[model samples]
Target: MGVAGSGKTTVAALLAGRLGAEFAEGDEFHPPENVAKMSDGMPLEDSDRWPWLGHIRDWLAEQAAAGRSAVVPCSALKRSYRDLLREAGPVRFAHLTGSRELLTERIQGRAGHFMKPAMLDSQLATLEPLGDDEDGFTVDVFPRPPEIVDEIIAHLDR
Candidate 1:
């Protein structure tokens, strides 16, 4: 999990492939209204995200129960959100982090996504960097997508 434009999707996809897990894009599960709100440059309130988070948790649990590991790309910007996800089971978050400048460039270069570049500020404002208590690995998104995936895998291996 990470902020927008941090290449979460790219890294998650590659990691899921390498791990033989089903890959799920968190954006795909967003409610239409949430997508519309983000598209209009509005940040989602906690109330707006609670149900969505629950949905993700349920999906993750289902996958785990099926004995299928899954890689999910989610922003999960808050500690509360991560706690909710953790309730699902032993899930590891691979956080992709980068400087605001780099993320801005990525957002600017992207096209046709529901999340507008303008919302980046709100996202950053809301984000609480992962704490020591969280179960995950943090990788800076600078080298390359493949390198990011490799880093995540290396971390998980430990």
Candidate 2:
């Protein structure tokens, strides 16, 4: 998980397809109010995110209970947020990271998305890189989506 322009959705979807796991877009779990706030160029407070994170966590738990592996793309920016999601089960994160300029360019390139380039700074400021204790690997976003997915899968294999 990373910021908005980190290619989480694209890579996660491809990863899910390759693994034959259930896939969910994390943004869909956000309440309308959260979406509205982001759309209006306002960064969401932690209070606004708890419920949304809970919904995503619940969905992950549901998938695990059903005996299915699931892939979800989320901007899990904080260690606390990642900790909350870990309660769902054995969650492994793949943090897609890149330079600020690259992230801004990617965000600007998107269209019809609620997240805008102007909001990237807020997200970057909020992001906490995966800690050594975390069950995850960080991948550079410079690679193609397939390459990124391949790297993540390779790490999982290790």
Candidate 3:
């Protein structure tokens, strides 16, 4: 996971296809009100996120219980959020990172997404890069989606 417009959804979707895993979008876990707020270009408070994060975690737990692998795209911007998700199951995050200019360009070019371009800065501010102890690695967003997925697979195999 990374900031807005970091290609998390694109990468996660392609990765899931390659890995033959179920795919979920973290944005879909957000409550309607949260989506409305974001649609209005407002950043959500922490109180608004806990439930959404919980939903994502629950999905992960369900997938594990079914003995299936899944890929989820989420802006797990904080270490605490990552920790919360890990409690549901064994999860390895693939953080998609990019330059601010590139990220903004991506957001600007997008359409029909609830998250507004204005929220990018707040996301960036809240973002905490993967830590040394976290079970994941960061990937630069410069490469094409397939290339990014290839890198993730390569790293996972290592």
Candidate 4:
């Protein structure tokens, strides 16, 4: 859970595979309108995001009901959004953090993605880092994805 270019999806996918947990790309949960909005370089407002967040939460609930562990990577930029996700069940966030320059470079390097590098500032501005009370830990994005996953797994084991 971090900004647009924080490697959330890549790391979460690898983490899910490592844990043998169900995997969902949170971006896939966004409605077409949301996609269109982002594609048009507009940052989504809270109202536009609530339903999308609900869908992700509901999917997690379904996985839990089926007795499966799941990993989903979401921007979840605000504490309120994370709180809402927790309503689904016990959720631990692995925040992929890095310097602004690194994040911008990563986003700029990407292609065919709805999220534009130009929008990274909006996401960064919106991001609320995990509080001490939150059930989560931060992992720097400087390490490779496998190393990031290892750190997360170790943190969970502890």
TM-score of 2: 0.98
The 10-residue segment with the lowest total lDDT in model 2: 116-125
Per residue, candidate 3 scores C-alpha lDDT tens digits across 13-113 of 99999999999988999999999999999998889989999999999999999999999999999999999999888999989999999999999999898
TM-score, candidate 4, is: 0.98
lDDT of 1 at 76: 96
List CA RMSD, all candidates: 0.8, 0.6, 0.7, 0.6
TM-score of each: 0.97, 0.98, 0.98, 0.98
lDDT of 1 at 13: 91
Which has the higher lDDT value, candidate number 2 or candidate number 3? 2
Q: Per-residue lDDT of 60-117 in model 4, one digit per residue for the tens?
A: 9999989999999999899999999999899999889999999999988889999998
lDDT of each: 0.89, 0.94, 0.92, 0.94
| Model 2 pairs in collision | none
Question: Residue pairs in steric clash, candidate 3?
Answer: none
Worst lDDT run of 10 residues, candidate 4, spans: 117-126
- Total backbone clashes of candidate 2, pairs 3 or more residues apart or in separate chains: 0
- Which scores better on lDDT, 3 or 4? 4
